[model samples]
Target chain A: MSLTTDDVNKIAYLARLGINAKDTASYTENLSDMLKLVEQMSSIDTDNVTPMAHPLDTIQRLRPDKIIEDNQRDHFQSIAPQTEEGLYLVPKVLD
Target chain B: MTMHTKTLKQLSQGLQTGEYSSQELTLAYLNRIQQYSALNSFISVTEAQAIAAAKQADALLTAGNAPLLTGIPMAHKDIFCTQGVKTSCGSKMLDNFIAPYNATVVDNLNAAGMVSLGKLNMDEFAMGSSNETSFYGTAYNPWADNTVPGGSSGGSAAAVAARLIPAATGTDTGGSIRQPAAFCGITGLKPTYGRVSRYGMIAYASSLDQGGPMTQTAEDAALMLQAMAGFDPKDSTSAQQDVPNYSTNLNNSLQDLKIGLPKEFFDEGLNNDMATAIETAVNEYKQMGAEIIEVSMPHLKLAIPAYYVIAPAECSANLQRMDGVRFGHRCDNPEDLNDLYIRSRGEGFGTEVKRRILVGTYALSAGYYDAHYIKAQKIRRLITEDFTKALESVDVIMGPVTPTPAFGIGEKTADPIEMYLADIYTIAINLAGLPAMSIPAGFIDNKPVGLQIIGNYFAEAKLLNVAHQYQQVTNWHQQTPKGFE
Candidate 1:
């Protein structure tokens, strides 16, 4: 399917990516071309086929709830763009 | 002695025999890295850490016994996190990010006593086919400066090809390792899905990503694999099965080996020169008592489209963690949370990355999810089944690593689809989650071509042996670029 400017804008919003107004036309064209390539999948009939997730067909392994990781909050937060009081600081949303 | 031309075994022997020391080897490599800066192979040359590690390796060497990779100077693809060093993954997003911990693969290599020279450059977030997408800048091929060295493992392959380092680590998701290895005339293996831990290796397409070795020979690749491949509890998807002694089977005979050549791989899409090289390599296998048979992969053509959908869809999800609040790039003075995310991502990600994120978002979005994402997954299963059916009668599958040898740097950048089609032969194997490798087969117009060997799941040892047997009778892997020699 061809992606229009509106479609590109909507998808960029969903992806949380800012497409500069200048680059939107190019983005739309590129995404449309990629979609055209992806459109080849329609040629095959996959009605009975089961969608595969992991290549090995293995289920995600889970471990019991326990704190195996040491608290490195300080070291981790030290690399953040902004952090205060042991939490990442982002622009105010609720306020 | 030309230290850079030495094989892993030769280097190991030199260290043990007291003819050379790891410290000297690392210093030599550091000097060479500087000399070859025009190639843009390295992202960060960890000179101080490398010397310190080499001194430690010398101590180990004096202590009598160390791993095969001990005292060896190598580099990790920037995609792998190295503690206390920048792990950019070739994107502006993580340019300032220093990984707090080493990836499991890095830990594995370190424990093997390998001295890490530094991290090599790669396509941004492992997104592009060529290193041009790298924020660090384009990496040049050692063989021909005008052509790409194949990517996102371009730097790893280029450095090894240029003999800047004896070997390096590379990850493959959709031909990253093999293609570059081919372009740069080296050996690269992508172990079976989950055969190696993904704990520290950055995720691209989770199911398709596998970390292996990029080396000068299959034997070296096998030796490196011995260290890198194993089950890791840290990576849930890491296989629970034991990693075989890959080095042990390097001399195994290929007698009566039932080799399968997929018709799809030999079709018109393949360039004449590459096809001739692959055919000649396959003939060499036949001369070694291997039986060749033609196999059909009816669904092979669909790989590119399916890969485009699934990889991007998964990448969109995987890259979400890169928001401004995290350790990655943050834009200045964001008005609010949404603006912080959009602007940070827009400014941080390159053109190709943004394009993929957008594509992925469209695929996974409402109403179109099944049409694109689910359909791709279904097609993935079909491609895997085709491999299974073909492998039922063959010991291994052989094909060309790329349709053509390395193209000029900006040759295909104008059109993204053209670049995506370059991965047709290699993507099917990743989609099937099988083990594969690309060994230097021959040169086409001075640019190296790779012979791809694929095997069933968990067949890394067998694949390495296959490439090893070929290398035993061939010198393609030993060929270095003119100035490099």
Candidate 2:
């Protein structure tokens, strides 16, 4: 299986990680090598197989919807890369 | 005696009788940690925090109300979140990351009066078989300075093995805890899925990641598990069933016990020394009156394959939250929104982590879901069924933790496939949602080999009982690294 530079960029795009043209060669080889390993899955016959999303088949249990934590904003935002007014600041995405 | 030689119960008793204050015990562990600093076992030591907590625990002991682990010192695998402490997860991406809240495991340990010693190093995002992938550097095997301590919980295992700390918490996604414990010659357990809460443990294949204890003995692992286990509303998948006293059956006799030896586990690739040591241990069990049975988990070959698909797919999704926007690392220059996402993640994650993300993204993509992801999930069911059937005829399944003992630091780090193969015998337990433990069985060429015990769903007590009984008759777990002390 061969992944082109375009494919690597597309996968990165979908994954929400940016990758440029120059890094594509290394990404291509790595991704292709990984796919070859993953290809081993194709050999196993999985007909009528039920996908297990969770190890246990139990449904989500509801909680009391109570606020058990308090006064953690200052403690939490203190670690953010960029923050102000109890919120994290990020690069502008708007026009 | 080394502070690490004492079990949780023994330490609790000492605290109760005023034999030693928590502060003194904390200082002893701190001194040992300093003595073994060359091992690179601890990433960050919270000395002030640990002493303060120990003082509080001493006050509780003075009041005759000491908890199960009151004043006992413990270490956390780097993956677990500790409020106001650096949580690198052995990755450069989170090098500067400081968790805002304590992980559920950390919270529970503190509640039980256990003092935090420090954060232990791990594989980058808990992704490797050896600790070499750690961005900080590889943790030295305290047993042999030239070799690696198994990973991604290598540091925790080393700390316990070197007698630096009594025990430490570890998270096993795909054999992280067990492999390291086996390599470092300590006991480590990964409870049945949902038995321990994962609220603050940094996500690594959320479906497979589980937090458990790595300690010098099975009984100590039980006490640590008792405080760490049980349901938490914060973790949706936590089992609602009552947690039994894990120590309740610790000293039980293994007579009439049925131990299953998986034939597939003894396949061609297994190292002869490991095989011999394991067989000797099994013979000891037989001599002790436990019956041995040959059990087959036919789909064993598919475990490694299925895990690669499912774990990476889940990891791809779990790690997306680490982008620069919310917290952690960010790029210096951001041309646009996309550039911020690209530069931050591209520069933050290591090569192996990025590779897994790409693979996972490819597996979960629309065209590949049924062919790759769904197929792996289907094979996963068969893997679980194999265990269910094997357990029906046997009380517990026993096998080699890894095909061989710990390899050189960089031996398997470059080859992803070889690294994946290291977890062949252990990943099935995670897929099946069963509790399993790794205990020191014997040595192979002076390196420790672990005997794996797999129990039915939520059978941690029985598993510990089997391990404790074996430990009573054997002294493998007591052998410490000679020069480290």
The whole-model lDDT of each prediction reads 0.92, 0.88
lDDT of candidate 2 over B1-485, digit per residue (tens): 55567777788888889888899999999998887798988899889988998899899889986777888899999999998899999988899988888889999998988999889988899988788888888888887757999889999998999988989999898788899999999999999999999999999898899999999999999999999998988898888999999998998889899999999999997988889989998998998899999999888888887888899899999998988877888999888777788889988888778878988998899998988898888988999989999999999999999999888877876667778877898888888878899999988778899999999999999999999999999999999888865
User: Candidate 1, residues B305-336: lDDT per residue as tens digits?
Assistant: 99999999999999999898969899999999
Candidate 2 CAPRI-style tier: medium
| Model 2 lDDT, residue B12, Cα | 80
Worst 10 residues of 1 chain B by lDDT: B242-251
